[model samples]
Target: MPHPPKELYTIADASERWGVTTDIIEDYLRSGKLQASVHLPRKMMHKYTRQPTECSFSDEVDVFDVDSCDPYSYMPQQGVFNLCYEDVNWDEAGKATLEKGGLYLSRPDDEEKCYYGFDEDFVLSRDKVYVSISELTRFEGEYGTTPRTEQQDCPEKVVKVSQDANPELHPKEKESLLKIVIAIAIGFYEFDPAKKKSPIANKITNLVYDLGLSIDVDTVRKWLKEAAEIVPRKKHKITPELLSDFGIPPHAKDD
Candidate 1:
């Protein structure tokens, strides 16, 4: 039942508040890390379909015309193949009458007054969240709802998210990283501050400082502790799709 806000925010709104360019916010938005208030069109009057069972329809009487029992309805000699529950046979009514393949698929029920339409294909991603805030501006949400079969683009991004969620790490690499992270906390590759420091830990620490990435030891411990307690990850087969999520296209998925 969640609906888009009455007012939406724009890229400029986010940019001005953070004092950063829209490009930065754009990345966050695409990654789903930031909740962007984009204008998601709702073709409403709305309604997917389920194969029908039972004839408990409320008062449409006159029922099936005596000579017109649908064969598909399975009543000895009832409804024809593809005869819709409400006695509609798109084949007979013709596609143009129903506006077949229209952006929104609409249909009528018992009362005929309570008409309905399918939501815009891309509208499934809306889940409006609200926090105590001031102004609201417009957002440009997605409008593409083509099915995966119809879509001639990348497949679903099923690559597993990582503990660190590094955009740089190939998706499969997270399995290795998870092991290492947990290993550090559990003392398997012990980062002993008392005894000799782990060469691996030192190298990584040096790498962080060398890259000018500043973080506290407490934060490192916190992440390691969390990683250690996580449900152990199973070995993942590396694939081109996994590679693509990490921002490196290997062309393996081209086939």
Candidate 2:
């Protein structure tokens, strides 16, 4: 049997279509470079019956049948639900949806076999998420590149820094600041020719603000692009594990 054309793609589907890892798609979503929507099947959205808190009759006349009151009569058609492990059985629903070639969200950090570690950061609700297939296709056309994991090591390029760019700072101070900025760009944003520099610039600007520094974003962006030109493309492959070797401690924060 043939299935209908898909109008939306799940994170997993987009990962497969783009030849990238799911982490990459998630990063794009987290960075606000992509959009998605939460969806639940109409069948699953049906309101569940609930217990009554009190009898409808007066306290002195509480001899009427409790079954007379409709459980959902006073309840809103839509409301919140507890999808926690102890409250709901999500594995059965997730499995059923997948078996039918349908996409469904799995429990986050579930101790059971269905755990996929999906979290509230991705979607507030336990419902599955979907991205417009056309929008994702357009994104891929603009930003798709060779997966970082499969990229071969390349020689570093050398770019001369303009000494007069920031004459107010000493050469030594500039060098030190550039090193810190480059380290953050490489370690956190995987700065490289294939990646966009705007997000990296914005992140560095925020960090500088947190540190009470006054550098403007345009300057930070200029410095990053210039410094990134000389960084070895291979260095973009550095993983979080290797960051410790560079003296970046685990879970280190400004506060």
Candidate 3:
């Protein structure tokens, strides 16, 4: 339950904060859009070799518990190790280096013997990179470069139509309605008669009426059954004419 370093965020943390994929964060680091630091455990030092016996340097060190998921030893005391780095490209081989804009202090030339540590069991880690929060001002406290999906785009049109039809609906209810309307437009719904005040419940009452559609579960079942009959026979692309057979007006679809 130790707190993560206040100044740094792991790739997963940055991904969530920026509303982007981990790969995007890594890309930002490579392009120099953000600065980063690598957390090198004492065990991961001396590449492909077993854990070392003692600290290489004489500085005061910080103790981080070994991640349970990591294959290294589970003993928390054994996980204690020092961190170090140098500025280098991620792809740099033969010598340990950062991916793009930071230093990797895990290993150094054997002759130089620049490793530093404290007296403790060697706790090596996966060599995860942490990004400084200060370097993230571009999209701080907001969603960043996550591209919108077609599903999101589709709901926007539905939301506009619903808002025009019912101006009094709360914004949150309208957002919920968009989801319900899209589900119905695509011919899918989990009709629950018992749940009365669900997101789609009252909001959809007016919408169903506005659309001149029946909300009865049995009626919807009949429509789905009929639609199923037509779908298999066509066995091809669904066009406006085919949609009309399912009671959808041709103009309802976006061009």
lDDT of 2 by residue, 105-143 (tens): 332233532211121122233234456665576675677
Clash pairs of candidate 1?
8-137, 9-137, 69-78, 70-78, 70-79, 70-80, 71-78, 71-79, 71-80, 72-79
Backbone collisions counted per model? 10, 0, 8
Error of 3 at 7 (Å): 3.8
Assess each prediction's global lDDT (C-alpha) against the native: 0.37, 0.50, 0.46
Off by over 4 Å in 2: 1-173, 188-193, 210-213, 240-245, 249-255
For model 1, where is the 10-residue window of minimal lDDT? 74-83
Ranking by TM-score: 2, 3, 1
In model 3, which runs have C-alpha deviations exceeding 4 angstroms? Answer: 1-6, 38-127, 139-255
Q: At residue 101, give the lDDT of candidate 3.
A: 16
lDDT of 1 at 45: 24
TM-scores for all predictions: 0.19, 0.27, 0.26
Taking the tens digit of each residue's C-alpha lDDT, what string does model 1 give over 83-201?
11122222432221223222222221223222223222322211221111122122222432232232333333333343335467675686667655644333323333333333544
Q: Please tell me which predicted candidate would have the highest lDDT against the true structure.
A: 2
Estimate the Cα RMSD of every predicted model relative to the unseen true structure.
24.7, 24.1, 20.9
Candidate 3 achieves a global lDDT of 0.46
